[model samples]
Target: MQTVNLGIVAHVDAGKTSLTERLLHATGVIDRLGSVDAGTTQTDTGEIERRRGITIRSAVVSFTVRDRQVNLLDTPGHSDFVAEVERALGVLDAAVLVLSAVEGVQPHSRRIMRVLRSLGLPTLIFVNKIDRAGARVDELVADVRRLLTPTVVPLGTVRAPGTPGASYRPHPRGYDQRLAEVLAEHDDDVLAALVDDLPLDGDRVDEALRAQVAAGQVHPLLFGSALSGAGVPELLDAVAALLPPSPPAESDPRARVFAIERDPSGERVAYLRAYGGQFRTRERVTAYRREPDGRTTATRGRITRLDVVGAATDRAALTAGHIARVVGLTGVRLGDQLGSPAGLDGRSHFPAPTLEAVVRPREASRTLALHAALLDIADTDPFLRTRVAPDGGTSVLLYGEVQREVLSSTLVETYGIEAEFGPGRLMHVERPTGTGTAVEIIGHGFFGTVGFRVEPGDGVDYRREVELGSLPLSFHTAIEEAARAALDQGCHGWPVTDIRITLTHSGYWSPITTAGHFRDLAPYVLMQALAEAGTRVFEPCRRFDVEVPADRLGPVTSYLSRLGARLDGTAAVPAGWRIAGVLPARLELEAQRRLPDLSSGEGLWSSTPGGDRPVSGEPPRRARTDGNPFDRVAYLRFLAQPPSRPVAVRDAGPERGHRSPR
Candidate 1:
């Protein structure tokens, strides 16, 4: 049977979930259709998600379309959960991008399209909710062509759009001049044939259209109302007819872990999208992960249990193009490559969280429990980063308030602990302004000497001037790992980025030199170098798009200006004034909150992540989690303290709580 891993993606409230429900019902996977408003959707089974009427986690379900097996992954639509979407993107064979007829092309819609195009994933556009009030089928289609790609060919037309009588009629499957014209833009043969007025073969045109769609160069647009079940069958037919299937599995086994969840008994269950070979029950697999230094680490684990999609038994083999729920790979994490990393790129598809909020327990006594729960959540969603302060206060990195709210609710519901979150703030990073070097020798009760030279560069580049054969690989790995972890909190307490660090010196007593010694001393030496280099702090920024009544443009622009927005461009639109600019991420929420009032509730505001810039004024400070290594006296004492003593080093990266090797 053929297989395709499909994803349904869209902006929030664009009816993605509703469409999922419609597809499931149409496929006879479920007898009764679930409603998003009532919180009864199959994919949205969490209590909190159902109550909120949104998808917090990506859900997977399998159904057959004739001889093809379709594993449909319904992903979160809200921007707060875009990391979920990012994870899903890596495992997909193709995607269905949903858009609302009334809302037309939204900011997130454009964002999703950009990612899909970048990945070259074949996509089909579903313009949903055609039977709703204010639906503009023609205008929305035109806008999709203008704002999105002009390579889209409408598969059908909607009759009586924006009314109860709305219906879809697919264009006849024949030689179409419009389809040929769209294809001609990319195909010289088609263009020549059209120009020469030669006979066009429908079979040839169909084959060319299929090839282009599979290449992601052309998109097909279909109009439907998911709520009314119109045009759904056509969409389903397109999935089987137009989109390509996953390639056959290779003899070598490989799978990418995309989603993770805990079973009812709290055992970790990872959803794997297999690319080659097969995963069997009780089989051992090696998991490979790429580190910050661009080095790959490997660990082995046995699969205690396995559940293959569309299989009749739990022990069935999970082959390529299928998804499975596997347990007992305790060290396996989201993005881990099982068996091999051959076909997967370890780069992140989405931007990191630019906002963070301090999470505090209401009773103050459950701080430890709150922190533990948060760590578990972070393990599931790697982008939802958690930090611990010296005072035991915990903060979580986030994309926006929705993530914070969901976190708060999850803490209360899952862990039975009430928590409060502080106001969100911009997450800043530091970069070294100059070059500086520091070295710690073996005489100070430690058996090793490690040196690092810090300089500005792109990403966390680590190199070595010392000979590779000078020390054991274990010791070298320890130094590289410690160096990367130290940069997690730089001189100003922000994660230092875009810097190059080179190991310039290394010396240790042969028998007495333990990897732990290098690990312990590397941070102190690196921090000293960063301080001498004088790091600069940079704050995140966002590009904003605003539309308001022509009469309210002055007030809206004035308010935005007061909030420190740099208006890069402006134009007059039929609805109002369209403004584009860059705004500090710290003030984005405030600007969004006040836009409606400024425009008398007729304003439309949207923003996308823009690269950060250095702060112009005095830089803000964050609570230091790493021992104050810049202060020689305090750091020496910190290192001298006994292992049993309570200390401020609660923010250890990756290896947190593990005793240092002696």
Candidate 2:
């Protein structure tokens, strides 16, 4: 049987879980439909997700549709869970974007659609909850077109009768003309025949619609009321007929490591998608690592296991399909592309993290345990990187607050370590503001002299690149590392950004200084270079959208102003007014509390990292005068100019931590 790997994506509370339950029931994978409110949904099996009644992570389920094995990935709808959705899309052959017939297209739905388009995946739209009163199929379709592309057209509609807030029967084919119009648009020949008043065959039109959908030129919309299983069988038929089997790309022999997983047994498994060529068990594959010294090392590991979708009755693995837990490859690392003789370079899709914070165990004894646990988690998700800070802090790069929370929880639960997360701070970059010259004299009369300039560059905004040449490769690497170390902690104790450095020219002795000596001396010279160029701190700003009843708009706006949030505008939504704004991330927690009180429990809000903006005016002075530890000169000359130690954090007086909720 053929195999297909597909995913269902939608906004939060848009009936994704309901649709998933109905699909499972229709395919006979489950004897009964699970309820999301009851927290019995198969995909939302995580304890936290079940408790919260929302999907926190993506789940994969396997089932059969019309004799073809299918693997379905259900992704979270909340923006905070977008990382899971992004990762799931990488391995999917197709995607089903779910929309509520009443809510129409939401901001997150449009965002997910845009991501799918960028990934070039074949997409299908399912307008769910049609049986709900006030569900307008035509209006929602138009909204989808306005928000996303115009490729989607509804195939049919489901009708049920009731007032707004009441349930109705799942009636089929109540409106056939709309379905005919959509089907006719699938092909020019069909439209011509329709215009000529010629009869159209249902089977031929179905074939044409399937062809258009497979080609990605059209997105077929199917209506279904998952609550009552209305139009579910027709939706299943559409999925089986329109979605093509995973194409054979195993001939190319190169596999890209798109994801990594760790089984319950504590083994690391690299999830590979073979863009080309077949992989067999026990074959020796080469691995490459780009080191800090600008050199690449080649290693080898034997493939211990091989599996494919549709290989088992459970649909474990198949060609061009999703597979998991195929363990036994010992030496493979995350993002390593495996091939027969030559290996492929697997770089991450997003930029390396720019923000970092210290995560320390509540008890000092658990430091190593916490470090080991974080390392293991980092292997599965490469975006969150960890390194030891210069001040003996465990520095971790995070995507955002949600990721930070997950990491903290994992550290606590997996390793029995209680971790305290420090404040989120900006990760900065360093560059030369102008042309300058420096000389490095090392042991045994070895001298390496160079002219350098730091300037700004693109790619990762607010980062500076050091462009240098004329020095030996070893010396060049040493210089780069030295520059990075210098910028590791910026003047304001934040990482630098949007700067570039150029080693315009250099002179060096061949045997006088080895790479090691240069590496050691580079940090001191880079510090001087950084001092020559002024440094500044940049803070992160978040774009937020808050929804509240119209009556509470005035209070919502007032609260936003008090929190230093700039109101972009307000739009009328079905539930309330959507107040759009940009606010500093540090104030987010307080803002969340204020909004609920302002709207009296009737307000909702969501925010994402919109990128960084300058912290307006000069930042407030630090309460203490303890200088930053990252400064080399300050530490080297501590005797001449002593720095203050950190003050003890004392418990507040009786009156503190006792504020009443307003």
Candidate 3:
């Protein structure tokens, strides 16, 4: 049987999880359909997700259709969970992007579509909730074409007889019209045959459409009401007929590490997608680590187990064109690829974390435990990056609030360690604005002095990259370490951004200066130099998508203007107005609270941090009230009083309310 890995993505409330359950039931993988409203969806297994009636993480499940195995990855739709969707995309062969017939294309949907295009993955569009009233299929399709991609063409339509709030059934004629359009676009010959009014065969049309889809030239759009199971069988048939199978290969040894997890037995498992080559059990493979020196070293590890999809037992050897779990390798980090000859570069192209928070254990004794638990979680999800601040605080980089909550829950449940989180913060680095000199003096007559210039670099978003070399390796390492430490405690206790530093020449003691001594003193000297040279703070900004009722549009625009946000654009959604804009991070919380109030609870907004910008404008002014008349009168009398005159020599000795001069 052929196997295909596909992902289902959509905006929140677009019926993604519900559609997933319907697909499962239609394929006989499940006995009954699970509902997201009831918190019983099979894919949303986490307690937090079930309770909230939303998917927090990506869930993978396997089922069969038309004698072909289909592995489905159900991903979260909320923008906060974008990292989950990104991770799921890395291993998917293709994607099914679901859209609401009434809502059309939303901000989240557009974002995911951009991601899909970036990855160069073929996609299918599922227009769900067509049974709802006022569901304009033609209008939604047009909006999708304008916003998402023009390649998405409807395969069939669903006709329902009702008003905006009535139940309806799918009309067969509408479905046939859509199918004919799809078939006509599949190939030139098919189009000609359809135009000539000649009979077309279903099997031939399916084959042609599958070929077009696999080539990424077109996306077949289908409509379905996952609730009523309308057109579900046709959707399943498309999944089996249109999705491409994995190409066969013989031991080419190229695989991507899509995810990392820990088994019940506590062993780390790296989920791998082998595009080519057979990975045999007990075979030694070389792994390479990316290092700063540009030298990669190969380490060998034996694969103890190889488990593949549809395998009945553990004895089966995993081959190419399969998602498999390989174990028995230690020292392998998440996102690291394993292969022969050991020097091949295997890296996961995931986005950097957007938000960060500091984590510390409630009990000091559990610090080590908390650290270990965080590392494990980070391993499982490469999107979470952990760094230790110079002040001994642990900082965790997260995607958003949902990830923050998940980390908190994992800490409490998995490790039995209680921890507290500081406010979400942005990471900034210090760069030089101009050339400056710094001097480091070691204990007992050892000194190192260096001349460096900090300036702007090529990267527009980052503060700047530090470029310095030609000095002794020991001294250079110390200087780099010092620069990093200086950044941790920025000039005014805030992180620095968008600046670069270059190290020129340095003077060092030949006999007495040591690396350790320089390392200890370099940071202080760097801090002093930065203070003398001057540095500025940078703040993060976000790209916000705000939706409000048409009547509340004026209030929404006014609120955004007051918050110092810039309007990108606006569009008319099904039941509301969508305003896209950018706002500073400091104003995000306030905007979130005020938007709903301004729109009378009819407005909704989502935002993602959009890099840092140079700090601008002066701080806000303080307010003061008028003083009382008594205080004013006292002030006037004090001002009118003459200054005390100098006393004579004899009188200077002592006086009432006066000091004596000797």
Considering every candidate listed, which one attains the maximal TM-score? 1
Candidate 1 lDDT, tens digit per residue, 1-662? 78889999999999999999999899989999999889989899888889999998999998878778899999999999998999999999999999999988999998899899999999999999999989988888787896678898998899999998899999988878889999988788888999999877978788888899999999999999889899999999999999999977877999999999888898999999888888899899999987645678899999999998764223478788889999999988788899987855558778899777888899988988998999989878879888775666788899888888898898998899999888877789999999988887777656898888999998988999999988899999899898898887886678999999999999889898899988888888888777768789899999888999999999999989988999998988778889999988888879989988999999998888887889988777776666666665556677777643424743432222222222
Candidate 2 TM-score versus the reference: 0.73
Instruction: Name the candidate that leads on lDDT.
Output: 1
**What lDDT tens digits, residue by residue, belong to model 2 across residues 1-662?**
67777889999888988889999898888998888888999888755567668886677677788867777878888765565675677667888998888887787887788777776677888877776776876677776775687767666655552223323222242324444466566577777777897766667666776776776767877777788777678777777888877777665455645455555666766666555545667667775653322235567787777655333433232234445444666666554556632443232333345557788888877777777777877766555667654343467887567667766776665667788888866554333334333444333223555444544543212222334445666677676666655455444444555556555444566667566555545544544444456554556677888889989999889989988988899888777788988988778778998777899899887665556656667542211111222233333343234222222112221122121111
Ranking by lDDT: 1, 3, 2
Span of ten consecutive residues with least summed lDDT in model 3 = 621-630
Where does model 1 exceed 4 Å of error?
A: 311-315, 510-513, 548-577, 593-602, 640-662
Model 1 pairs in collision: none
TM-score of each: 0.92, 0.73, 0.73
